[model samples]
Target: MTTGALPTQTLPELPRHDHGGCINKAIQIAETLCNDRGVRLTPIRRKVLELVWESHRAVKAYDLLDRIKPLETSAKPATVYRALDFLIEQGLIHRVESLNAFIGCNCSDHQHELLLLICNRCQEVEERPALEVMNAVAKEIAEAGFHVHRKAIEIHGLCAQCAALELVR
Candidate 1:
């Protein structure tokens, strides 16, 4: 984890890579956004974001709590939940409904439809900003007489690398 200001990772760069650089970029964006909105990026909140972006896989709140204990001795379930809520509200992270876990947002520049390509074999997730698809879905939902709110779509399958590995074996 970074001890000071976080690094910046551009949107175009997040999809095909997972490393310390990507996490740092996300943290920097979150920090800037919070600052712009006059929201406090508390230590706990920052830590929660860091933990969520530790890998491409989504992280459960309880698992986040367990990880926080060593750094924040007094950390509780509620505390972690609050941090998760804050991150979600800020668009710094997203909750995976199917998996019941959270993953860092790849596109924090603006609100758009997020499509997560989840690799079943490796548990890796890649974020795709699909505005056109989201708009079409919204139209269909409206035709059904339902109002729209937040949008997240998850498609589960093997990523290219994993699929290739399977073919090899």
Candidate 2:
């Protein structure tokens, strides 16, 4: 709805719930929504997202394999990898390329290009759909006659709590 209109709410300074409970609710909600949309909530996909969501830090796929059950020969790397792809496609999670891992995105609805602010200390990641830089970049691209499909913006820095700790020292 923000194609041209101002945002309905100021972006949250942080998410709105107990971390543990919020994540659990997000997964359950995603499952039910997927079911209603006639999408398959396969066991492997659920398990993978759960494993990623449990961590405040980005978690590697191999690490997730360890957290979930070890795979049998019948299920090769592609099985879990494909599930991760689907999860990302659905906007239920984000991939941190620097870490070569994934993190759960707790958005209740679909959004445009993602902008992530990652805390180095706590490793907590927050996703926002800010269009400031995105719109500028898109305008530049259009001037050059290039089309942009998908974009993800990641800015790594200390969060509020971590910044306060630094000030005390």
Candidate 3:
């Protein structure tokens, strides 16, 4: 992470509330986005998207394959990978490079940069739109005569719950 180029504005911490509605809302958004983009949300892709939204935590590719295998007897690694790739390309999900996993995109704003926060203790992941951060980085990159095609920041730390637990001790 570059210091001088990054924006200083802080975003509100993700809420530790029920995420059932979040999952449902994400699915609806995915459907609309895919349709608008003239992409097919095939059964495999839809299921994979659902699995990715199963939690607020990032899910590894193999883990997703294992889960889907039981349902589809002929499921293969390539099948799940392709579905994951499509979802990512559609902005319905994000790939956490550091974790080699995928998580549902919590933001609906198109073309906005995302910042992922991972809680080490609980493995909870939060996705946020950090436009200011993106702009600052873009400016720096442009100054260097380079264009940023895409960028995402992944930060690992304890969430409020886990941090509070540590404080009590």
Candidate 4:
């Protein structure tokens, strides 16, 4: 069994930051990973990934489809879903179950447990590699003899910027 390493958590400054870098880095990582895995990152899949990396916010499938239609006129719901499925399979993105939305995975280098911090006010989702928390959870699951297939801990609250804004208000 491969033990996942905890990545350094750097939460973005929500008010101001170079988001273009985020999008570019994500695309580059996706391209490299696809090449390494000998899988095709088709045009549609790449575009879907780009759209998902547009921000740190969670986006709905229908929203992605609507945004993609302008660029990919032939795009349909199935097309978007297929692209989403492929991205998920490749560990390039994550599905935010609570909001029924998707967000780009910053740490796509390896498969690891997810700890998402979602801001209720701004809807931005931050992914944290809580290694200790996950290890504890794993221990408990093992004690219960539960075979875990997938695990993601989604905690919804105010992000730093939103919380600060609330304080001013």
**Model 3 lDDT on a 0 to 1 scale:** 0.79
Best by lDDT: 4
Candidate with the greatest TM-score versus the true structure:
4
Q: For model 3, how does the per-residue alpha-carbon lDDT over 57-169 read when each residue is reduced to its tens digit?
A: 77888889888999887878998899988998888899887777888885777574778888766666777777788789779988999876678888888777868966987
Q: Least lDDT summed over 10 consecutive residues: which range in candidate 2?
A: 1-10
The estimated TM-scores of all candidates read 0.86, 0.77, 0.85, 0.90
How far residue 18's Cα lies from its native spot in candidate 3, in Å, is: 3.4
For candidate 2, the per-residue lDDT at 160 reads 81
* Best first by lDDT, ranked: 4, 1, 3, 2
As a whole number from 0 to 100, the lDDT of residue 119 in candidate 3 is: 71
Angstrom error of the Cα, residue 86, model 3: value is 0.2
Predicted candidate 4 versus true structure: per-residue lDDT over 34-141, tens digit per residue? 999999999999999999998888888988988999999999899899999999989899998888899998686655588999887678889999889988998999
Runs in model 2 lying further than 4 Å from the true structure: 1-17, 70-76
Clashes of 2: 0
| Model 2, span 1-169: residue lDDT tens | 1222112144224444577887788788778778877888787888777878875666778877665655433555678899899988777788886556788877667464778777765566777778787788778888999876767787777778767866887
Cα lDDT listed for each candidate = 0.80, 0.72, 0.79, 0.86
